[model samples]
Target chain A: MSCLGERLTALVDGELGHEERDRALAHLAGCARCRAEADELRQIKGRLRGLSRLPASDGADDLPTDDFLTRLRSLAEPAAPAAPDDASGTRPAHPGTLGGQSTRPMRQPVRGAGPGRPRDNRPAGRAVASAGSGALRRHQRRYLVVGAATLFLGLGAASYAAGGRQEAPAVTPAFDRFAVEHALTSGDTPMTDPLTDPVNQIQTSPGP
Target chain B: MTRYTGTGRARRRALVAGGLAGALAFAGTVTGDAGPARGVRSDPGAVGLLRAAADAARRVPYEGRRFLTTWNRGRSATAEVAVTHRPGEGVRYRASSGAEGYRPDSAADESAGIVAATLGLLARNYSVSRVADARACGRAAHVVEARRPGGGTAGRFWIDSETGLMLYRELIDATGRRVVATGFTEIDLDVPAAGPRITLRPAPPARGADRPDPDMVDAQAAALAPWGERLDGARLARLRSEGWPIPKDLPGRLTLYDARSDGATVHLSYSDGLAAVSVFVQRGSLDEARLPGWQKTVRRGRTVYRREALRRWAISSGNGYVSTVLTDVPQSTAEAVALDLPRGGVPFWTRLARGARRLGSAANPFG
Candidate 1:
């Protein structure tokens, strides 16, 4: 009832015998979990094959080289455990197992060396895939920040320009003081006239 | 008693002879010197009488009930107030309803000396003559008439013969219709031993700390800052140089006789001998909402606020200045003066710069 985990990779690579492949496909039809893993393996294999066809030294820096693709393909194949005399003492991590999440550990690019240079035991394809996705996310975040800042400054300038003239303070003229002041200057008694007196002002409509 | 009567008649005859001789001398001087244009027989001594009347307003001490009457559209409106004058102190006016107002002597000295000073303009514009001697308010008075050059009496004044105080005055239009009349209905030259009690309303508080003044609000609205002392000619000239609208003359032959200013407002008084108009110019636009129940009129593409009761008031605002013309003249005259003031808003660059400053202030973190 468990999945044919190793056989699924083998089935995707077409390395199994005809009878074995037919048996694996029959099991995959009954087990959705195994079928999904087989499909992911097939896609990864197809991408690696495509990457292998790219010319070496293509001038585009971001594109991984043919040597990196070869290393990635080697990392993708399932191999037996290394012997004790092997220098690395372990096999390179499998590319098929790479979950493609940004949080997953990836190989640091070798400094002062082209992507074709082999340095870490980690799979080159997984590292390039994770790094490329992270770079894309960073670019998207930068664009968002710049757009927001532009909008803020634009709105501020617009508000300032649209704000018309500054008017003097709102003032209600002192009719009584004006009356008294007028009288003082005009040689008349400082008295508020009946016209300016609010109490005497009838609430009348505008006269014709 | 008969001997006293004979002496009085002799004195009367001598006074008449002296008046005639003085008139002749004044007429000869005016004719020989700068005579008025073409048959404008100006009684040179009449100007002195009017000036004396203006001086008597400040020099004499008296109390009386004065009435002002203005006629408009065939109806007359009259307002009466009790007035008390002191020789050196000031004048106090009290309405029948118990509202009181006071003007200090310093204010009158610095400003009102203008009324008498502008009488030369009156003489130049009118053919002033001492028309007659009449009785007014139970006192003998000298009648002085300022006749228009075309032949109608423009103004008449009844000056008390003994005190030289103006007892009554009236202004008449070209149609010989009475425009405005003010006079003492009852006067007592014998001042009371104790001056009348004063209960003047308190002045408004300083700017930004002001509370509503109930008396002022009842009379008009929120009180404005009191104007400083009257501005002299030099100061007025300086203000004009600094772009203040201090015109020397207005329509209706009203010459600027007095000018005063606070920091924000400039008060200019103009008169044509018969009518006194006060124009108050302040830097700002009018808050029309504050003027409730006032009539809004537009003349010659300008908006004027008109209010007519016992006096006429017209207010207009433009070119960063709000001008209010207050007088007892007809409403049409008030409107004309209000409309005649400068119009148009502030320039575009000025407005833009002002707007920028306001924006900067709003954006300041500590503002």
Candidate 2:
């Protein structure tokens, strides 16, 4: 990548600042090697999500769900290679710009593609991993989906229950009584307001 | 007492009264009769005419169609009521929709549209003056205008020339816009002088007599019910000790002129003399979901449900008490008064407990 290094990964993760993201995208449009690398990074990121579908099994009580997600996430971080000079040299001098990991090693290319070589034609690693695990991974994914749905439905029911009111009887105000009471002291004739009293059919109009 | 027509002996008597009123206007002898009638033009003649109008409202027998219209936020609510008044028996109002209501003579102070107490307040707050003679409902009327300190007309009243009865009244806001107006569209003198007394007796409904018209039964029941337990200073102080929000004054210079209770609810009446507001307080949380068609608003974290009609209604609830503020004033004034009333706040623990109880009730089928 002549003009971009960790910035390519940051762009794929959508973590770059607006201006820095624009610059990285502009460089990717002209550089074929960086474009291939961006495509490869996207593929690996997709496979990582597929692997994350595995439920944190209670059988391995030591591994919590958050820890499992963190380990799965670690698989996508790639080393930031030394960037060659760009035409304008506007790239940030700090390797850690945009929160990208610069000290890591380059990710191992899956499906036997060599490092630094384009792996566009290789089958996604998700497919290879699923094929190896067979029905076991499928069962774990089904359990994860069912657990998530149950959690969602249970929380919704609990919230509805919390919202239910008690202690006070449902009261619809006696508006007719209220009107007369208001008039008795308001110096108007002690009578109900025809408009406020639902029983009266006085036509109310808008003012200019 | 002899009943006379407009051009008969009554007109001569009215002319003589007018001359006397004009003489009083010039002499200013009745200046402090009600209160300090201080303004640019403090005409006690106008005050006497208004006081006479209040007395005539009860002393004169008349039947007419009166319309009340209130304006708020570029919208208006109007009500046309057919009214019948007797000397001893009070006014009976029949709405256009055929709904009937009764106000017994005892239930009303019969100070016309301006109660005696408020007349004093009006005099204290505005300068009362007899402006001119105007015509209303095809009858000659003496126009009385009350002006604010800044010389703006706060209110205007048109009193019948011959009978001294209030024919029309309108309240004007600080911005010179009419907030409320009520008056007779058409009137007929039943009898010139109040004549002999008449008693109103509810006709007994025979067994299975078609249920006696539910509306009439309701109206009769309302009339028969105890008007209200008038709250005096001692009682009001006791209520205050028990956490009732019985403030002697409210925003907009409205002072509490009357307080009453109907066992379960306390009604506090406030007025700046021209504009009146009533606040009703009851013990219970407001059933917000049941207030269908009401506009809900939250200001400064307080929720208020409001509705505008011939009058404005603003309801709010907190700390196990529900308060409803009703008035013919502007919507903003009603809302401000509703929000200004004291209501206890619910602490975090109380809220949590309430939530837990609700959850328990929901989980229990029998709850």
Candidate 3:
């Protein structure tokens, strides 16, 4: 590639302005190879632009057909009549298989059995749905039990925390005796209590 | 000068004997000397000053209004009292408010010479030193301070240097905060003519008995009704012989001179010459509900309740033997004595009640 090789891409993309564009044009006019490359790039850009202008549905292969839409609409509505069963009355020798080919047994309500008892003729899908619902109910019951237990535990803790604290014993003081005793042990002379002498003398308990 | 000595059985015997001597002294059956039953010697200086004060309170013809300030919780209460002394007769105190609330105190310390054993105890417990000369009640006063060995002044006294009478006194705590201050606000030295002789009538005896109020005995009996037995000198001697856990001296210089018990609760009277502490111990629980304004603090895993009333520090505490220590000393001394009481295997229930009382006190929003 020559020095003009890089300029060929810039010229085709119109990234060169004014003087750069004129220089690239003059180089392309002088270089036959660069002019051929620029012409090819121009044709590719024109084709890409024309393609971008086309409608979105130009390729119909990415869309759903009329038959597919009819099928989806029928499925979206309420349950319709069950698909027709095999017309042959003979049971296959392999039980669920006819000549090594597996056959799907259509679900048909049991006529001789209970009124609402449906025959288990389909695949194991119905059994899976039944087991799933049962397990869900059990989980719900478990959640309820767990919630009730948590509520009880929380209440008990709060009650214990809010209850009263322990207290100690009370001993009252004899102010009269204290002051008197204080005076006594202190060097202060005994100030006679006019009210207590007779009672003191009277209450002198006899020695046992 | 050592007030208490000896160890073990001998010590117990000596304490019992001393208690008997104290009992005799309390019963007015003996003079000042209770013999060497308790290993305490009388201090002449303190004894003489106290005797002089007592004599002056009675014999000196003087009239003055005394003001006493007492601390309650963090507040102070004052008593404005007018005192009239007439020789050869009783001292009369009249309140300024004239509420007819004049009640003469009879529980004076009746030591040999002094009216109170207080000064003697003070001299025994504290080292007394003369500070300086001051004035009190408009008279020349000699200042004396009663200092504890560890540090801090327990009490200060301003005495009339000429008359030897106590004119002012102040009781202070470890933090040097005044608990009680009593002094004459004004004085009239001139003696008035002897007014008509006023006779004071005695109030009726308590409990309708010919005898009067039984202070701790009743309170103890009410608390310890089941395993209670009243202990006198003889039983105390017997208990000493049997080896009980009674202490001869408490945490401070407080010497236990007399001990009485009603089966469950034991009342031990301790004196350090000046300050007197009475400790009541019982086997039952303390109803902390009865105590208000009492603080709860824990020391060495034991709960203590401290409160001030009636010019004394009252502390209630116990693990098994609920001990309420009431004293004229500082709160620290009272709390120490309460925690150091005899701790035996008290029931879990007692501690529960103690804890409950502490909790109740803590929960109470008001003092």
Q: Each candidate's lDDT (Cα)? A: 0.66, 0.66, 0.51
Ranking by DockQ: 1, 2, 3
Q: Write the per-residue lDDT of candidate 1 for residues A28-108, one digit (tens) a residue.
A: 899888878887777887786565446462234322333354466556433523312221212222223222211223333
Candidate 3 chain B least-lDDT 10 residues: B219-228
What DockQ does model 3 achieve? 0.04
lDDT digits (tens) for residues B1-367 of candidate 1? 9999999999999999999999998888776422443466667688788878777877888888888888988988888888877766566666777665555555566544566656766776788899769999999999999988778888899999999999998888888999888889999999853454433333442232253433454542332223665688899877665546677877877888777776567889888766789898877777799788679987787899988867788988865667878888788888888888765355445555565677668889998
True contacts kept of each: 0.26, 0.20, 0.10
CAPRI grade of model 2 = incorrect
lDDT of 1: 0.66
Q: Can you write out model 3's per-residue Cα lDDT over A97-182, one digit (the tens) per residue?
A: 11111222221222332332222423323422343565345446767999999986675554343332323234444334333333
Please give me the DockQ of candidate 1 compared with the native complex: 0.11
lDDT of 1 at B169: 87
Backbone Cα, N, C clashes tallied per candidate: 0, 0, 41
lDDT of 3 by residue, B1-367 (tens): 1444444667899889999998977766344233222433334674466557666654456677767665645777555656666554434555433322222233222332332444555655666777778898778987877776666787888888777767888877777888767777787767663766345442321221332334433211111010113356677665544324456677656676656543344566777655567776544446567555567888788778776543444454443345567654556678788777655432344444444555556678993
* Chain A alone, TM-score per model: 0.29, 0.30, 0.26
Instruction: Give per-residue CA lDDT, model 2, range B50-124, as digits (tens).
Output: 878878877788888888788876787777878778877777677766565566666566324337777777777
